[model samples]
Target: MAGCGFDDLPLTRPGPPLNAWGLYGEGDEYGRLNLITAQTVQAGLREAKEGITINLNLPLDTMPLNPTRAPLRHEIIHRTHCNDDHVSFNTQGSTQWDGFRHYPYLNYPEKQQYIYYGGMTSDEARDRSNHRCGIQNYAKKPISGRAHLLDIASFLERHQRSPLSYFDASTPIDLETLESCAAESRVVFKPGDILIVRTGWTEAFFGISEEERQSLPHRQKRGSCGVSSDPEVLRWHWENGIAAVASDAVAYEAYPSVNSPSIHETFLAGWGMPIGELFDLRELAAECKRLKRWTFFFTSMPLYVNGGIASPPNAQAVL
Candidate 1:
């Protein structure tokens, strides 16, 4: 395939896989790396003036799953006597992000890496007590920034096109349709900006009966379909210097891709991007449409566990 000029194809080769944070791409011409040393909670707090800060967290129990696939557990002791004078009921669970010690790819740790600064394993990393970027990373951060919402569902609705009752789990995304949605929205992106997308899938999940949701598999091998994002769009985000990308879908990239899930591979492995998935953008989308402003403060706190693989972001938008 390299002989076919395929070497230049971004997704053709194996790169780093997605971690708890996001993809980290290859080095650049000037030896610069993708998504290296992003702004941490300390940095964010230094910039905030103050206003009404809205929380984007949807209580863990309210979240679709009991616990994300991340490695962690909680023990509940119904009856436990600490000393008889006081009976102590104990419950233990890992809150926020999964440390690098939580997961090891190819049996390796993220020691000296971005999130994992000191060591790799939990023991080596000092019992995973570090909170470098943990939920605290978002503390004191300003929720006041330029935010834009791309409502793909409304774009489809205007054309009288409706997503499948249960989006075709096997269909590849239509790139053209995605471009059309952007055009219809009259949205413009700037460098170092935050981007948000709405697909209305989150609502569908909520609307379904509990029994129905329980009956469905966690994720289907054949994925959902719609205007899937193309490489050019992904490149646009990078070239335009987009700081972050948020989506209300299960996975940001379109399912059943024609290009081998290039978005995930590139963003996670190649660029070290920070993705906000399973975000609650409905309120923000509605406000953007109502005001026709399409801009606001986009903020989120990712799990800051060192060497962690993934974390549920406490995302929010302040308009």
Candidate 2:
């Protein structure tokens, strides 16, 4: 658990996780992503034993949009006698990756402290001329690497644990729980690895009738579950050389944070880590159980929109 070597970057200096701003060099859009080296991708390629591919995306618009926000307005126009069509929908209406621009470093204590990675301010983002940290940087060259699937839900089920209710606000999967599951899976992690965790919340959410599911907004809550705001969890990730982390949960961190400096502050803001959420893992987890292996070659393609903040990851796992 030395440092991320961010201090070694040309424009960066030593700072305990706070100054990764210039780690990959000032104006660096691909922060921790730089960890995905040639060796990392090669290792992922080596894991494609049978070339079996699994798609990991939930159907878009499966539930009506939250009434507070406009519903996903989708429309398809067909050309007469030409067998052609055009369609449009929100990029984040389904599975997605929260990009570098999605969050800012809120831990800055100064009253006028408005800064982001590389010490850039929100004003920088306003200038459409320079969308430096936009998610498009990853899209221009999609993500491909080893994916470690930590099936937290199934692990709990096999042990006959009590039911985990996502709507209950306090159920959180912390580092120790994650380690227990990883050890059970017998999978070893490597640097630059893309991690995926399944909480079973998505399945339960989708199983309810559409009417019941949509009623979530009325209750002023959504049935969600995620990793706890445990510093140890973040430390473990950096120390293990994880490139990015994703989950089959809504926020990827518990809905109601139990502590300050939530994972979002340090991860997305501090280390420039990528966070993917709401991915469908029921099928992939089943495959991992059947094959007795949890590692696979993971690939994801976000829409190649210029300067976009976030986008759906048409993610897939090849085992």
Candidate 3:
């Protein structure tokens, strides 16, 4: 762990493709978040110009079961004077972030190592004293940094001849297209910056009728536009020193992940990286368009649900 530079990270890939298990340390729970240092916070502070804060959280009930994972159930408890509402929902029900415990490094054939990120044994994940990764770590010390929004949907609509679909889960948002959008937005990419991408999946889902939306089957094998599930994209994430990358889609990467695994497996399971999903970027994106800027001071606060796998990101962007 001593004298380990960023270049010397991972030491060696315990799992194939690329694994940053030992990059932070044998006991590291917060992976790339370690990059969000004082410098990054200062950089974020510099971007807060208008003091206009855009709420990135979508309504909890909006497509609560879009990913078809779990439906949110609620009940009301009426007291003598006041009534209390009880809500039961999955961490990913709505606008939320995926914790390290949510997925595992399952590409490998080894049963023990494939159980979770960093090749962690099952016991390590459930052990007491919280030795393994926990979402509360981020809750305690939230990730504050310069946020760059790569509004993919907005850009696609401008160039493509035909109307862009809500999402092309089957199609990977190729790097060329991604960079073009950034160039168009004139947003500078920086290390430790949090990138929020919008593919218009959430907007498309909410645009439907309530009855029609509810009638749709769960977990449908449909496509959503996201970062290309390619090796180069992963390389870009690591080389750029990104703290985390989020999207307005269900999964940050293309559904079915094109060919190779995307950030879902490698980021959360391999590198212990975190990801935000299903944020409301309509207002933020509109503001960016008016101001001619895509960068902001981004902040997210998670609930301190100890040992919880995921939580709703009370996220916002200040510009």
Candidate 4:
């Protein structure tokens, strides 16, 4: 069980489909993150030959992309000569890492029974004192590893001569496209590597006017381009030893879920893998193309909120 492959899934008896519940150990809080060992850290450090650092977080003041989430609020407190500011907003309102408790698998659709990672029930996740699989676990260790950029949009335009209809279109970036992009970039996958993909979503969002941006949430039939949530995609990720995945898309998977048991359910709830969404990858992509190097040292530290479901990805990449 300690060295199981993708074929040896459902480590728990009578577990959810494609689950690796006990792969790390019973009640393991750090799911696939367990792959980031000292050796992996050393390997990641080797990628930082150049001293170029790129910020991967969108501005905290960026307009709320999700309609359900409230816009960021900031209030300046006047303290004579010194001014203090109080800010509050949803953790997932911008670039964020979806923790194990953020998305749960529906164990019984009829009864709407949902379960978090390590078999944590909704009640356990909601308990104020319980922190079984909270984002704090990640905050304690943080996430650092060698990351490879796929630049899917660039690949499609260059290779297939097919540009995406729109960043908000319901386009699916399949496994073949991913593998092909990696091959072209000469990025060799390694265990504990963080996969960062650029779908031009964030770049396109910035291209629109503020009025249009304000109306994004009100649009009808709006869809975002992202990686396909097909079973093979999950298998490929597990087989390739990807520790985590991030994208510029809203959900990190095609919105509205084209498949049963969406990637969010399997990756976050079943496998305990973090899903980073809305990461500002435009500058990173440009730098990677300029340097002709897609691999870089990536690091991220989430907020230390006990029993929190998600947090802003205070992430950066060094090349």
Top candidate by TM-score: 4
lDDT (Cα, tens digit) per residue for candidate 2, span 14-120: 32234466656656778788888788898999999999999998876645334553345556566775555444556555688887766666656552554555555
TM, every model: 0.61, 0.89, 0.90, 0.96
The C-alpha lDDT values of all candidates are: 0.46, 0.75, 0.77, 0.87
Model 4 local distance difference test score: 0.87
Clashing pairs in 2: 21-118
The sequence of per-residue lDDT tens digits that candidate 4 reaches over residues 166-247 is 4457777889988999999999998899999898888788899989899888778668888888988888888888889999
| Model 3: lDDT of residue 58 | 82
TM accuracy, model 2: 0.89
Q: Which stretches of candidate 2 lie over 4 Å from their true place?
A: 1-19, 64-69, 111-114, 221-223
Which sections of candidate 4 miss by over 4 Å?
107-112, 165-168
Error of 4 at 124 (Å): 1.4
The total number of steric clashes, by the backbone 3 Å criterion, in model 3 comes to: 2
Note the clash tally of each candidate: 23, 1, 2, 0
TM-score: model 1 vs. ground truth: 0.61
Residue 176 lDDT (model 3): 78
Question: In terms of lDDT, which candidate is strongest?
Answer: 4
